[model samples]
Target: MATVVPEESTASTEVKAHEVRPPRKPSASQIAAARSLPNNNEAVWPAFTTKLPSSLYIDEDRFDEEHRKLFMTLPLPLAPSALLAEPGSFVCRDGFGQSVILTRDKDGKVHALVNSCRHRGSRVTENDEPAKGRLMICPYHAWSYDLSGKLMAVPRREVFGELDKSELGMVKLPCVEKGGIIWVKMDHEANDDFSHVSDELVADFDALGVADMHMFALRKHEVEGNWKLILDTFLEGYHVIRLHVQTVGPLYEDTVVQVDRLGSHLRQTSARVGFTKDILAQNEESVDDLRRVVTYVYTLLPNVAFICSQDYCNMLVMQPKGVGKTIVHNFMLTNVNPQSEKLRQKWEKSLELTDGLAFPEDFSASAATYQGLTTGVVKELMIGGMEVAMEHYHEMIEEMVARA
Candidate 1:
């Protein structure tokens, strides 16, 4: 018989820093959640049902308000640092409804520029793919800017006599690189203070080794649903045993999740079928892989979802195209580059399991749910006990929207 430990017994014990920890170990919150894992016969559930208005998902006016208040004001994690691994590399992205260029200067500093030329207002580089170069020259008139967005050269410099180069630089957005992710605020006038990104969230990501990972694969999907709906699919495990039954269902325990709030953000940990308390009792210095026994999902509120698997991590960036449209960018990251053909094939297989099988199931469900909400018959969506994290998520969004 499996012995069930009381939640207090595990929750009260502090995990010391001096103890030898496992590689790519759990964050402090994750450690606590792991310690409180319920036995096979025991179950955990939310205490109340959260009522969310259908307008939150289908009303265009409400969507516009959210876009203005939350999306425009908050700092969003836009891209993986591995996307700009080499100095002088850059990628043009328009997922946020604005054409922006992310570049790493020769000195290895990252910058987010408006992507338009200072002179003619044309995009400096149109290529969406990652490329390496020192200067971004506008094809319109050959005006050029360096990787740092400094207007370096003008073909007809003599034509514009007394023009100040310093005042002609491209519009630069505030950017910060932390936890191997590039966070950018869309409002150029907003202060550079990123205090909204809490220390606990960064420490959790650092523990997951996101900074040193390799960008294995990236895929973008356009879904006919609100961006929040797409994000809701990742916040709970309630549907895994139902919606994903044919694919990833059997691997996860239904309604067996541990959720902790990291400020406004959330961290959800779930044990696999074979998980045992003994897994957590192993010597911290031992080479045991925690990912084998548990899975971690980090929701960096309002936009990103980071899911950790045994081998690779999936980082999903949900960009709202409209009230009922979204562009979901999925990035698969691994600890090491897949140099060998065999290794590349191995990761490819994992991608197919997610991007191919499991993800489509969630996307389809979100799209269908949005379609139903648009009919105006359903006034309120009930968030049940199994989806408590999602309830907290919506509450945070409501608070931010109201305050902003």
Candidate 2:
């Protein structure tokens, strides 16, 4: 018994609805087209509303910009005690490209130097093990360098004929061992002292018991993505629900995490909503009686993550391989106490699981984003309120990139 509306009225209503359509979602090709637009610095604040040119991620010009702007003057780490595990054990690798060499002198003093030798640029040490005692011979030629990067001997030194032997030593970089970690400054003009960054990070570093930690898991990964993109994944907790759905998603709350800025350094911790206590109580028999019950996350200046739990810690260093690639060094550290085998194993396993899935997930996500960006498909990326830390990070990059 319902009456039908008039055809003319129905047609008029349909026409009005058709006239009002929501904004169209931009396609990948559309995004690329948007990149052709002019540079808009105004879009960099809360959201970098305008997508940068795809070339920024793949072009040689953009890579050169990053090299000159960011990597040209990076700080170098150098400290014998920081790199030492036992009385005289040490290890080191390249801060930027492919290079690493470890040496333990006869006096129980350890020196970690770059692989390249001073005499005609030959690699001094092999990749197998730390060279013992003083003499280290270069692989390319018979040139040799002493423990302190001194020109110990050169094949047919007399034939060189009046060449200054003193000046023909390996080029040493500015480095320091602090809080159980070797830090090398990459910039030649970098300040000799690291008191500024150290003083700020000392308390947190001590809290992790870094002074007594030993390296257990040392691994490096090469991936296709900007180093910052990989770093950004670790800097915030906003992506857990989306990116780490199966792994860390259940452990952290997307909205309740904390982010604190210490100068150029960043520190953060996730609230477990009583889950940490629950996990501890369930595994009380396996965990030690006197261990920290809280999970801590910290990021030191430049690029280092000190993720520590009650039993052990993980130290990660991310180095930019190129504009679109990065090299990551993941280290497992434990307490000096030899009796904590059970506790150490439990902690190490937790870190292993977390680190294990993280890189793979991030690699996939970052590579996909890079493809879209490089293909000229996206004009802008939109980050929301939960990703405030990420926005802050990008803002700082903009400022640094724009300076000078």
Local accuracy by lDDT, each model: 0.79, 0.53
The local lDDT score (0 to 100) that residue 54 gets in candidate 2 is 50
Tell me the spans in candidate 2 whose CA falls farther than 4 Å from its real position: 1-59, 76-83, 87-92, 98-114, 128-131, 188-198, 275-294, 337-348, 402-404
Locate the minimum summed-lDDT window of 10 residues in model 2: 1-10
The list of candidate 1 runs beyond 4 A from truth reads 1-22, 283-288
